[model samples]
Target: MIKGSIQEEDITILNIYAPNIGAPPYIRQLLTTLKGEINKNTIIVGDFNTPLTAMDRSSRQKINKETQALNEALDQMDLTDIYRTFHPKATEYTFFSSAHGTFSKIDHILGYKSTQ
Candidate 1:
């Protein structure tokens, strides 16, 4: 996690790193932790490992619990997943799978709704 301020505005930035295997509760936990400390500004960007929605991942499976948790945390924080927010119909991926020949957007940039 990293923090900074410009003029009177404070911003917290985080680069998440989720585990490859198992449920990544840590991602949601981090969001919760940061939400607790927030005054107004925050920027969370990283490899979430799990997609919060079906569109985020190339898989046809149901939405994962940890992903829902992260989504809930983001809502509580009044943070918007900027990538998804602006590019509603655009499908892009930050990570690619060689074996599956698929691309998944596991990385994200989340921030307060008021920010760009």
Candidate 2:
């Protein structure tokens, strides 16, 4: 968890990695369980490993159907992708594959509706 505060408000950010490409169901369940631990105003962030686009080939890993489905699950959960929102440019890359030096925007900052 990434901890930070703005003024008097405290926020807890969660960093998660779904080990498998088809792990959305498990991930969503985990998020649901964790939601109770966080305050309504807390901010969640990290590498979800879910790709919002199949065309986002800005990395070595190929964006497959499972990734796209995971992205949809995140959307359905109402998680806001802060980086993409602030940076509309497609050149933004976050993760680098050392093997291929391919960079992709897999890292993200997501916030609860109350905090955002």
Candidate 3:
């Protein structure tokens, strides 16, 4: 977590790198911890490893526990994906894989509903 002032208003920034191997449990743990730190002025950014939705990837992927946890966390926290909030139908991506020959947007920026 980083603390600073933006336009004289105090803010908190949290950067994360969610593990792919244990994403389900890690997301659950992260959400538990975030419940205490997240606020209107908080911003969360990360490479979540798991896409929050099917549209976030270029290939068909099953809905897994990790994705479920992330989605639930957003609802419970009242957090919105900053990019998706603005460009709901966009097909942009942030990550690419050669071996799988697929593209996915695993990175995200999120903030409270009232923040944007």
Candidate 4:
């Protein structure tokens, strides 16, 4: 997890990286638990190992229905993807499995809407 604070603000950023498979439900539960523990303005960032669609993937990337479902879970939690804001023109790739020869765009930075 990435943890840091800006200047004098109490807001802190926490980053998480969930496994590629069977991570959506757990992630949603984790988010719910974290939300209960931290202030409303806290920010979360990470490689969720899932995407909203094939469009969210790179030319060499592949995604499944489970991955799409995970993305939907994030949306249900009201998390805002910040990578698009920071690097609109750049493609973010977080995982590369040399053994499988598969490259996926699972990395991301999601923030709580209340922070902005």
Candidate 5:
């Protein structure tokens, strides 16, 4: 957790690094704990280890239940993906897997919808 002031407004930033596997359940638990701490000024950035949508992954495979749960949790918290908000149609990736020969966007910067 980071605390600072921007233009006289207090802000909180949460930086997270989730495990490559079993991230969805962990993220859900984390969000549940963060509900009381996060506000409109809060910014959450992380390597979530799972793509929130089909567009975020290079593969055309169906989105998994765990990933879907993560999206629902973020939506329930009113957190919007900062990059997607600014570039809705862009297809940028943050992670590449040589074994699978795939590229995915697993990192995210999220903020309250009202702030964006």
Candidate 6:
């Protein structure tokens, strides 16, 4: 977790990059690996490696574990997926696999609703 003060207010932020080469429970480990106090003020931002949900990807295909852990973690942190909330129906990809010829929206800026 990255910690700093903005205008005299303490703020902590997390940049998550789940292991693409790792096996199952990638997000679970990423979420729990941090050793800091992640309150509602903390902001989570980065390339999560795994897409959070169907809307986060160009394909209509669903990703179960990724979605579940993302939602649960957000609930646990009382954070909001701001990008998704703002552009509900928009299709945007943060990453493109040149080798596989695919585009995916995996990176994100997640944080508390008040922060936005």
lDDT of each: 0.73, 0.61, 0.82, 0.64, 0.89, 0.71
Q: Which stretches of candidate 3 lie over 4 Å from their true place?
A: none
List model 6 lDDT by residue over 3-106, tens digit each.
89999999888877766754226655666565246666777787777666777666667777656775776667566778888988888888877876767787
Best by TM-score: 5
Best by lDDT: 5
Using lDDT as the measure, what is the rank order of every candidate, best first?
5, 3, 1, 6, 4, 2
- The candidate with the higher lDDT, 1 or 4, is 1
* 4-68: candidate 3 lDDT, tens digit per residue: 99999999999889886786568668867768888899898888776777788899677677677
lDDT of 2 by residue, 1-116 (tens): 67788797776767777653555555666777876666656566656655555334464356566555556656666665666666656666666668766666666577644443
**Pairs of residues at least 3 apart in sequence or in different chains that clash in candidate 2:** none
What alpha-carbon RMSD in Å does predicted model 6 have with respect to the real structure?
2.8
Which residue pairs collide in model 5, if any? none
Error of 4 at 59 (Å): 4.5
Number of backbone collisions per candidate: 0, 0, 0, 0, 0, 0
- As for TM-score, the candidate ahead, 4 or 6, is 6
Predicted candidate 5 versus true structure: per-residue lDDT over 1-116, tens digit per residue = 99999999999999988998898889888988989999999999999888877888899668889878888888999998999999887788999999999999999999998865
**After best superposition, candidate 4 residue 79: deviation in angstroms?**
0.9
Per-residue lDDT tens digits for candidate 1, residues 1-116, read 77888797877777878887643578767666666765457677887777667787666467777677767877877888798888887667788889877677878887778744
Better of 2 and 6 by TM-score: 6
